[model samples]
Target: MPTGLRASDAPTLQRLCGSDQRLFLRIGQLLQAKLAFTEPALGEIVGNEALKKLALDKRMREVDATSFATLLAEHGGDGDLVLVDGEGEAGWRVIAVVDELGNPLLAPAPAEVGGAAILATLSPALRAPVEGLLHAGGDEQRAAALEQLRYAAPPLSVVSELMPMLLADGAELVRERAINLLVAAGAQIAVIDLVRALQRGDLAQLGRIADAVSNLA
Candidate 1:
């Protein structure tokens, strides 16, 4: 079993230990260098060996108070930090929280400690078709991929890569699907661009914007 200091541990320490009493600890024992933190609400998963290996592979260094505190603040003080390995050229290592269905509450930004490629999740299978959709391609193939993305959300980087051209696609069907997928993916920038498109006289985008508003509601 892995034992460590967590965001919640501070309060527990305060409750158990007097302020004047010096309580000493070490990161090696408390943080274990290879474990992750999950709040009780999600259930206990401490000392997860697979996650420890994943962390080591990602080159996750020792957990210092500063890093732990920073991550805690970033996490809004409560949640799990499950380490998951990334795939493809732009691989990433993330210490992140997930919703009940296991979706990342926010996208993990590549950390400077581990410099990997740019788009971490787009493997060859995904990269080929996403690139094809973004670049020169038949409208039918692009439309098909755009529709598929609603169920299988691509990495945010891929979504960003496809946004410019697809949003302005000449084919109404392709453009509409692209907008729907973007909205579903919760891309705030997509809504901003949709509004901009309307300002630029693309009145056709108004309905998509309305749909996005309804989704938000």
Candidate 2:
């Protein structure tokens, strides 16, 4: 029960919190304005009893608890709830749980890690989504994606898949992180590619990539 939210607001909040993307955007904007001021508002949205119950209900359908737990842990902490709809003859559907403030409770880690692991397992079909998260906006999301990449052990044939991103435009921290992971994973060809990029001055990345390469030799 966040301050300023009346009992009358509950129903509307519940509906919006269910799966409303626009409401989420609005909440994101508000939170960006000031998290301290918005905490109560966020608490109200994330703490909704109905939403929690729905998430629990959705969790019951998962066949794998480890997968479910990972997903829940990733997205749940962010205040986003994931709902899997469809049962019996219907197919399962994913619904993002948004708090009243519109922040998704689900963290991006599980998806990133799971997706990367799937890729490492050579399931080409799962690569795109996992790679997509590598470019996700938040530092935490990018970090999670990079951590997954670190663990992927992708072969040289697939090293190209991640090369572009490691050199793409992003925060210095992200680029540095990517470089470190690639190096540690013994992505030799990828490192060579990065070295080429650095030599051509094609990548305006942080000084760390160059430093990393220097140490590698």
Candidate 1: list runs displaced more than 4 Å: 1-121, 132-136, 189-217
What value does the lDDT take at residue 131 in candidate 1? 48
TM-score of each: 0.32, 0.30
Compared with the true structure, model 1 gives a TM-score of 0.32
**Per-residue error (Å), model 2, residue 206:** 14
User: Which ten contiguous residues of candidate 1 have the minimum total lDDT?
Assistant: 20-29
Q: Please, what are the lDDT tens digits per residue for candidate 2 over residues 1-217?
A: 1122211122233244444433332332222221111234334445664433333343334423245446556444443433323321123232333352333453334544422644655655436545665447787677677667556655555544554434342455666666655565566543554444442344343133434433333
Model 1 per-residue lDDT at 58? 27
Which residue pairs clash within candidate 2? Answer: 45-100, 74-107, 75-105, 75-106, 75-107, 79-105, 80-104, 80-105, 80-106
lDDT of 1 by residue, 49-111 (tens): 333333333233444434644544443443354344332112222243444224354333445
